[model samples]
Target: MSNSSLLKTAVLAGSLLFGTAGATVGEEADARKILGSMTEYVSSLDALSFDFEEYHEIVTTDGERLGLAASGSVALVRPDKIRVLRRTGYTDTDLAFDGQTLSLTDSDAGLFARHALPGTLDHLIDTLRDDFAKPLPAADLLTGGGHGGLTAPTAEIKDLGVGVVSGMLCDHLALRGEEADWQIWVAQGDTPYPCMFIITSRNIPLAPQYRIEVHKWQAGPVEADFAPEKPAAATEVALADYLKGARNLPPNFIVEVEK
Candidate 1:
């Protein structure tokens, strides 16, 4: 797929959990307020860390839809420092940005890439999408820089009331966009943070979904070590080359058998 298509697919696919219940005006307003609170509270934090479990549905060439799972952890410090580590069945990767430079490493391939991109976390997200044609899932919530970044494209909103995620009670919300539908569960009270997020493609044939569940959320001062440690004997290559090499890795999803 083309870069633009990739971005759209990622955005749409990144858009999942919701209910079919109709919402009243008051409930809609309440839902919007809850989402806004989450944005504000997450953005205001100086540092935070969270573990996430991700599920992505992929359509195979034969038109079979299969699910892929990955787990990762994210650590961020306000202004311009962040580290993301993801592990899948096929590969283990690390992406780090330390204000001045961006580093990506594929431990399985023994290859790494570095680029100079000096700016805030928001700028980093834009560069990744526009320049590098990369997708950072849940980026809006993670960076929390752009106002209404998540809700701006929303066409409708619904309050699904409360739901439990990992045994924690959360306020559930469902949102509809032009090309996607998404849901979020925000933990109630003073520290309003997202406990779970899901995005489902509305335009895609199979309506594939991408889901993220946050676990072990920690907010406060954390070590700002965004620079990734380059593995010994690993080859350093251009960013584009690293991305190309990554595309050749083994498929991350498994095909389901007919029951």
Candidate 2:
């Protein structure tokens, strides 16, 4: 055979053998192992709190990408109570669930709404998404099943080695779903909390991105932390009415569609 043809044949043989071996190795690359450990730690906590900085990217009709930044804090108490405070240049929003009632307040508009909801934190997370079309900030990490529910539909998970985020070493994981791509950096060592999260809407026009960077994390938050401070003069309305006003506001993460 010609020298060039022999080299091509060797390359083909090597690739076929290596491809099979690579698949075998990739099958064992279950990043879920790390995620499961983190979940166990998170679920075992009676309470938790974290501070985060978040950003959202949007593509204008002119194809220009615009980014917005916001900072927030989250507190969670297992089974029921949770609270979140988010501040942006445009608005100050707070959400609190005290095991019996769920309240939402937007200080920029001087409006507040409360709805009775008695359930676990997981149920609260689902209700906000299904009923109100609102996503609890960084909730995928706080949900009862933790990464389980969030990653159930993911088709591919890859370990992207180790990296440093917010001054802590982390195990970087990348996941690909049918519609989106996500990356998470789980802190290393005894505490495996996720220190960073990024999601890209691959199906969108510009494939816009949303990212959250965690700064502070703590466990065992007190019960009083979940209480919402309702303004005395703030207007109260039905959940639907409250959402009508909120529907125009930018969400913590980008929704599939924009109004």
Candidate 3:
């Protein structure tokens, strides 16, 4: 069987094994409602900042699944400005999008790239994904209308009840998509921030997963600069060249868009 066909079969097996069949209609409705509330609350924020830990699993040629881990912080202002800093054992990278330009810097490699893309945060996210093939992890939660974006491809929703993340009580939900399955934990109460997100790829052997856990979340006025500062010794390069160089970097530094 082809990989895609095998993936379909594996998805079916996963649905059965994960109890997706047992989710009741009411439970599904509740799960969707919770997700909507969380998205709405996040959209209403004028500015937000958070610290996160991320894990991405890769399946080797021999079918051994190994994980790569990174820690990062995100700071955003509504509509236009955002900054993300990520650090792994081998790389320290920074991405900043102001109103008129987007910049990416590899601090460890002494290289940087810049592109003029004038738009909102949502547009920047789309450009990064569609044009550059760099999709930020848990990006659905960062868009202006995240509810619609996330729910558009959802085939099923399951309320898995409550969980505690970073000492905060949260509502756990599972959602099945056309090609993959994902889960989220949203903090309970009015804030309703996302505490954790996990996506598993059925198309890959051993079902590699990507996970993000939010350690700190803050929403309000952020007093900081959004301008991208090029490192003094860093050489500027075309965006494509930057991406090419990324492939030579440590594991998980290269972008891998889902098929």
Using lDDT as the measure, the top candidate is: 1
Query: Residue 71 in candidate 1 has what lDDT?
Result: 93
Clashing pairs in 3: none
Off by over 4 Å in 1: 1-19, 145-149, 247-249, 252-259
TM-score of each: 0.86, 0.82, 0.86
* Regions more than 4 Å wrong, model 3: 1-21, 144-149, 247-259
- Computed on alpha carbons, the lDDT of every model, listed in order, comes to 0.83, 0.79, 0.82
User: Model 2 over residues 66-106: C-alpha lDDT tens digits?
Assistant: 88889998888777888898998778888998888989888
Residue 132 lDDT in candidate 3: 76
- lDDT of candidate 1 over 1-259, digit per residue (tens): 8999999888777663333578788988998899889888998999999999999887776777878789999999988999998888788888999999999999888899999999998889988887877877668668552522366767789988899999989999889888888888999888888999888897988899988899999998776568877788678999988998774235654446678
Global Cα RMSD, each model:
10.1, 7.7, 7.1
**What would you estimate as the lDDT of candidate 1?**
0.83
Given candidate 1, what's the lDDT at residue 111? 90
Tens-place lDDT digits, model 3, residues 1-259: 9999999999998888884346888888898899889878988899998899999888766667878889999888988999898887788888888899988888777889988889998888878888877886558767623522456658788899999988999999888877788888999988998898888898778999988898878998776567777789899999888887753336544445668
lDDT winner between candidates 2 and 3? 3
